[model samples]
Target chain A: MVSLSDVPLTKDRFQTARAAHLWLVLLLVSVSVTSLAVGASGTSLWGAFAKILSGQSLSQMEKVVLWDIRAPRLLLGISVGAALAVAGAVMQGLFRNPLADPGLVGVSAGAGLGAISAIVLGSTLPIGIVALAGNALIPVAAFFGGWLSTIVLYRVATRGGRTSVATMLLAGIALGALAGALSGILVYIADDRQLRDLTFWGLGSLAGATWGKVAVAAPIILLSILGAFTLGRGLNGLALGEVTAHHIGIPVQRMKNLSILVVAAATGAAVAVSGGIGFIGIVVPHLLRLWTGPDHRTLLINAALLGASLLLLADVISRVIIAPAELPIGIVTAVLGAPVFLWILLRRRGMVDL
Target chain B: MLIANDITVQLGHRTILSNVNFNAQPGTVTAIVGPNGSGKTTLLRALSGDVDYSGQVLLNGCDTRQLKSWELAAERAVLPQASTLAFPFTVIEVVRIGLQSGTSGETDSVAMQALNLVGLPHYANRFFQELSGGEQQRVQLARVLAQVWDPVLDGTPRWLLLDEPVASLDIGHQLQIMDIARNFAHAGGGVITVMHDLNLTALYADSVAVLAHGSVLAHDSPMQVMTDAILSKAYECSVKVNTPPPSGFTYLLPHSAGLATVSQDSL
Candidate 1:
């Protein structure tokens, strides 16, 4: 039996989430600074900033190392990291499962296939197409590829407005294998120089990050992230299921369409630049949801912050752990993320009925 | 007034609700009662715009098709038979989700007040998934209650469209929920619920719509709709309706219960 008692109601987690926002911003800034300062060239960010603040010219070594190399890599890292994490959070919300990551669900693999096709087959394309694409051919193709795969996965996994976790993951495996086989064929046909590029790119790295790649990836990633922010309320409503969401005034169909497009563009741009970096999407959002409540209004933004910081930190480890030669950032993330994924599965095994 | 004219819901070749014309006014507890697969829930869904039915549903004198979803939300709140949350949310947070679209005057304490009305104010901080089935149902009812907190706003009545709102509760809690629905209607709100318990429906409903084979078999006062002939025909069983002394409200006992008692007496 329940009694009607006058107990003080606990407020929603908005304040705590807001306070955490402040801390996450601070953490991202510090991680960004640390990433800039810790590369192999050892360009001291403090010296560069201090000199710029005092109106002094940068040394030639500092200028080349900091501006030409590390700066673009850092920006790319932040964009890709935020894109992956935010995409993960949005995908989980859309699918209504905590384990639904874009990378794990073959979106990144589809994008990877698109990027490899561009790299291996770009020279054979007509001059007009090449001229039209300029530097963005890879990212644009990857966007379509990722978009196609997301739609396929969504259609295959969801029926009658209900998503089955088992079907989604299994479909992801099939899609990943299909993408991998196609990428392998492209790798087999590559010329000697393209082969060298494909070997490193397939492993996933921030090593080849350049100003040109950053210019192509950053805008698409940022735009998609902005689109994802508008989906917080809709996603929250969707957490109660589609019918209930519509009853609460959310445009369920439009929001779901926007979510699919946002995820594809973000993931396509990221995979075009950074290869198949896995686990940041799954790990960052899962951690944030555990830290605060699973309120997407805060969760999406916090996921961006933590994703940026975590990826930058991983990039730092990749650079320093091997010194002159670096481990692929993908290797670092998988080593760290796969265990967390397993732990989450085990913890939720009895609770979620998944 | 809520009106559904020529509401026909067809799933594949089978028609779920066929040309059903039903109307409910403000300030009344209207119950939709039927046997299994009799389209009770489908009629509710059609009226709430959750299903695609070839009919026009008018809520408060406006065509539902022309009204935006938010406009419809402001006019009514729906309670599905069961609600499952993908992510963990506290009880109050879930309630406030309704308040986001609701045109409530006192927004701050209405969620808590709704919880209190459902007698679960103390569970405000508990995780929704952690609650029992009945408790979770009440929490959803509280959320629906918070959506249309005021029965009538600006002289126009709001609606609480519930599907099997008390199907999961025990006897006492079923009474408590029926009382809440009754109170909501008494305060000038319209309550239309799909109910399984005919006795509870007879006790609480001002009007009852009886459905059999995807058609409204009867729609009138509970006394008219809850008769033995209608019950026996609709349910395909012999139901003996009784007007117990002092209260005189109709209660039903399946005629098979008497036969089972006779066999037990011989044994």
Candidate 2:
């Protein structure tokens, strides 16, 4: 019953896109500054900046806290946030559905299962892998686990060059449950040391983020993000449907394959490092879509920036809310994101069939 | 020119179109008409290269399958029966999707002109999902029109392969759409439409192909094919084709089996 005339066509879409980009960039800078400033210790960002600018030598503790700890954690937070949001945007475009999310597709659970196995069974792993991984075994295993689950999910959902979104969703749910059960068994067998590691990782936090982890994760995340940006036009064509997308000169099958690969690489790298931060993948792109009119060209870029900002803001709150003891970043995102998601659903109640 | 020879489409064990030979020449409107299950849409799909068939489909004397997807897109545009979009895209954004193929500069202006041709010039910025069914159909038609806005490019005529383009439209919009198709043909482009309204087909189509049971029953001028026996046999019902002496326009009147008894009881 919605009337076409009632929807105004006054805004210039390009101008709106430009404005959204600018606003999100500013917001990201401000929130990142805030994230680096506020932490367990009361080191003001200005104090760190002033100390560096004045050519004064900082104490070993101050250098360790600022350069070694906060900087890397902030960098990891931004990379993981941007990766999850971009993956979500690409997955939504590939599935041609607004509700599609990286977590819903079993990527997070697979990563969790991989991380748990690495934690509980590290001693049994081969000597070569242990030497190569050194301290980074957990994230590397998690990345491979995520990639494996995605390959399985994609194979189960695709047949004769067509991917059924419904089948993908159902199979993802089943796979997630299976991964969760395996992770539970691993947790049951773990000693006290491994038990603590599993508990903290299960809750999802950036407390363990380090420069070494960022070095391992940033390249894959950045490459996948760049690859995803190139798919904007093809995804736009796909919004019309597969046949029309083909008619409009998009290589439909190739686009689908590339989208799936990009999403897996990006989300796998992110979950490997961040330990399954929740809701940013689903919430950031959906929220931006309401403002940007669902054009993937602009939506993908804005989602990256805004996703980074929101996750940093959430990280800041998680650090400060409990002071010396940090709350899990996943819990913070769910608390902040769940209500916004419900509001979106309620606003679109009559328009879309859930 | 678009040509299909011995096109046979089999979905699993059932054949949807069997050895269906069809030709659509440049500068002409060809209508494919049939009953509900007569495979008119399937025949159009085969001609558009949207389905795999056993026979050859030639576009401008080249085998259609040999052409790359972008090359085929540059030559023809298809308006499907229905398109469902999951996102809330603006009308112009949907139409701009057509600009993905060839070097069509000034995409916004081209899309606007296509929308103007469909009599919805002001709908460029509106959300596509908010439109009514008929409006949505027009938006799709506009998208198709935008794809082949230039009826002829470098002396080669483009084609519009439309499947039930006017199915959801009212009478006024139906004529408007038919006129749009006719104008494209007059401008030296090919138009092949699957139609159910025989009267509209008679008025607008340069030639008519009547299909029944996955086979072509008749293919000729409307005057030659719109006959009592041919239609009645194809439709499996009593039909009368009438033409007045001066106007020379055909009107078809179908007789319902139980109408006489119902009318008598009411009287």
Index of the highest-lDDT prediction: 1
- In order, what DockQ does each candidate have? 0.59, 0.49
Q: Write the per-residue lDDT of candidate 1 for residues A221-255, one digit (tens) a residue.
A: 99999999999988989899889988988878778
DockQ score of the complex predicted as candidate 2: 0.49
* Interface root-mean-square deviation (Å) of every model: 2.4, 4.7
lDDT (CA) per prediction = 0.88, 0.87
lDDT, candidate 1, at B263? 48
Error of 2 at A187 (Å): 2.4
Q: Every prediction's TM-score for the first chain?
A: 0.90, 0.94
Residue-level lDDT of model 2, residues A319-345, one tens digit each, is: 999999899898999899899889888
TM-score of each: 0.93, 0.94
Q: Which pairs clash (backbone N, Cα, C closer than 3 Å) in model 1?
A: none
Task: Judge candidate 2 at residue B196 and give its lDDT.
Answer: 91
- What is the clash tally of candidate 1? 0
Regions of candidate 1 where Cα sits further than 4 Å from its true position: A1-12, A53-55, A131-134, A151-174, B101-106, B257-267
